[model samples]
Target chain A: MNMSRIVRSTANILFPFILVFGFYIIVHGHLTPGGGFQGGAVAATGFVLLLVAFSPDIIRDKFSFNSMKYTEALGLLLFIITAFVAIALGTTFFFNWLANGGIIFGESVAFGANPGILNSAGTIPLMNVAVGIEVIGAMGLIIMYMLSGIEGGNKE
Target chain B: MKSKEILTAIIIAVLAASLLLPSALMVFGSPQNDGMDSYMIDNGQDIAAVNNIVTGVVFDFRGFDTLGEALVLFTAVLGVTLMFRRMKEDEEYEYE
Candidate 1:
């Protein structure tokens, strides 16, 4: 077994586990010390590892910068829209009016968790998840591009 | 960057202060808001509605600015990449 194939196998086996762990950190952020930025960085590590083990062309084909561009913008827009909704409801901008215990899907889950200490912070947890997704995609794309240059590929 | 300059100045100030340690005793700064401490503990949760005080302060009270901070590095990367691409294209055209 050569180095590249071994790397590929290792990355494939580990990527899903890394993503699930990242999601766990993001959802449980309010209760624990990890939040959007930390979880997002962790999530991006999988993409980065894949980029390192594979070729740049594969990285580009798998995750396009254009899609990441939209994902980043959408994340920001979602955050803004969430804040604006609060404003439209007659509260100040970015107010957590709905965070204190709102009913979602006929069940009450604290901001991101159910009946837990992490449940009190309303939209903050949701925002963390959104930001986490955005940051992971953005960082993954950026790192992949940079790695392509180092890997002797000029096509982006 | 003004932020970078300000950070540099703060480091310099701290270093200078270490040289003249006597003034450190007189460097205590007063709080800006008269009742900020009490108000924070009393009405903090209600205003931001976040269980974590830091989260409320960062995302709720200072959200607009946080968006700008997040985009700064993204924009910088995009700018550098564009400039490099433009220069490379210009060089290739000149060669042709």
Candidate 2:
């Protein structure tokens, strides 16, 4: 279903901003109220807005099914490998081996309540990004599938 | 018609059971004692090096749970993709 010009223009205006907001939520998941899944859903909502405004053919041209599938696979793979690497580091499986160890993302945290540093958490942030990517891909693909499968969606 | 009446009755019974069971079983705004609460409050920051307790709990302290959840989502996505595969041979699904 094609939206009016006003709705379409508003969606065009709001699309990138929503994407940026979603990324912000994902990146700051360790320190903020939002996280990977929430951010990914937000991103998917932006895509949905675009889909509602434009045709499925147009949206499909911008984002194909294969790209999203591969992205989901890559995110899951990254998450698994990150966990296994902790095992490789002589820690137990899914261990926070990088925390407070003075490596990358290994900043020691001061005890007690305060605003958190972005670079403090080690594997958590990495995992958050992975999960965020996975969620975005999965939700976007689902929305695309459902929208395209609707009656008369294939016409024109 | 008989089956529809039975289904409607069954639905009402289920709805009543759900509504009544929750009121009888749960106490609002108060939870039972939790051992992990105090432990995480004390040591979560030192372990995860992160400020948010929930994030620490989900991604660090109980990371295996997160892993399981991720796998579940992956499986769901796979199921959706498979279930909605293109019907036409010439469809542009990009399986490759």
Q: What share of the true interface contacts does each candidate keep?
A: 0.21, 0.71
DockQ of candidate 1 against the true complex:
0.19
TM-score of decoy 1: 0.71
lDDT of 2 by residue, B21-64 (tens): 96788787555775678789888888889888888888888889
Write down the DockQ of candidate 2. 0.44
lDDT tens digits, residue span B1-96, model 1? 699999999999999989888665554665446586656545656554544555555666667775675677457557645644424444654444
CAPRI level of candidate 2: acceptable
Q: What is the lDDT of residue B10 in candidate 1?
A: 97
Residue-wise lDDT of candidate 1 within A60-119, one digit each (tens)?
A: 667776676777667666767777888899987777656644543111332332334555
DockQ (Cα-based) per candidate?
Answer: 0.19, 0.44
